[model samples]
Target: MKSRYILAALLATATVMPVASFAQQSAPAPAAANPASQIPAADKQAIQNFNLTDDVFNRIVKVSQEAKAQGIKPKDAKTDFSKIHSLDDLAKQVTDSDPRIAPLIKKYGFTPREFLLANLAVTNAAIASEAKGNPRMAAYVDQSKVNQKNVAFYEAHKGQINALMNEEPDPAAK
Candidate 1:
């Protein structure tokens, strides 16, 4: 029973793992030599353009964390959340593949891509917020600013974003 909750949390958080990986890789560069700047304008724009709300964002974070904790092994129960770096590690804790996530996605009436976009928006905001005080993370802070701008753009264009998300065909349906 506990495993089930952890599996769900991990699955929820998995959506942001890719972005987190990108941030980690680029976070160490000198602020002036930031690698995130090399990201194509179109790609950056796309991320900025995605929309999500604080209510949904908080829910995802809470649910994912709860789920991840539930899934932690008794031996590994002391593991820090930051130590679980990869999505695969989280996935492994639950089993071969997560069967629980699809239902949650369905419950939210979100296609996988929509869910991912929502996660990306929230994660970008989170990364930006975390980078605020640390000098070593200046590059990420810059990137986070861009991401926050994109989130704002998303909010401004929510109707169109929703239309596009709704139009996207669910991968499972195909």
Candidate 2:
């Protein structure tokens, strides 16, 4: 009984003193030579497969929203968002005639819409930097069919793919 009491006291003291958490600091890291800043191979490919019609942009936006709801930590979601300037930029990019991305997507069997949704999840993290009236955000004129496709992709892949970039297990807790 005496040992139990001492153990409890020690545990209480440790809890009260606190310990450093592994959580990353809220501040953005300093700009430096880092690969995370560069768009990954997948992102670049999705850009070439993109068809920048309004429909596609709308779809990508919906995918981004769905990604957020699915516990996707934007900062860590897939590739970094800083690589994209705006929805238009992204749509145009995915639709670009990049020789690299188009062939890769063909090999992977990813539909253009699927590629676009993935692009949104990856890039939405960059919004913090672009939201300050970045001309890249663009004005919303209307929604389109591709928008619906994006939302659907988000619904289907939100857990599987969108979750990839955001999930970080609590190893210490284990």
- Alpha carbon lDDT of each predicted model: 0.45, 0.33
Instruction: Please give, for residues 102-139, the per-residue lDDT of candidate 1 as tens digits.
Output: 45544556544455546556556545544555666655
Error of 2 at 10 (Å): 48
Residue ranges of candidate 1 with Cα displaced over 4 Å: 1-44, 58-96, 143-145, 149-174
Q: Please give the range of 10 consecutive residues that has the lowest summed lDDT in model 1.
A: 1-10
Question: Each model's TM-score, in the order given?
Answer: 0.43, 0.23
Model 2, span 84-148: residue lDDT tens: 43333333344352333434444444454455434443233222222324544322111121234
Model 1 clash pairs are 5-67, 6-67, 6-71, 9-67, 48-150
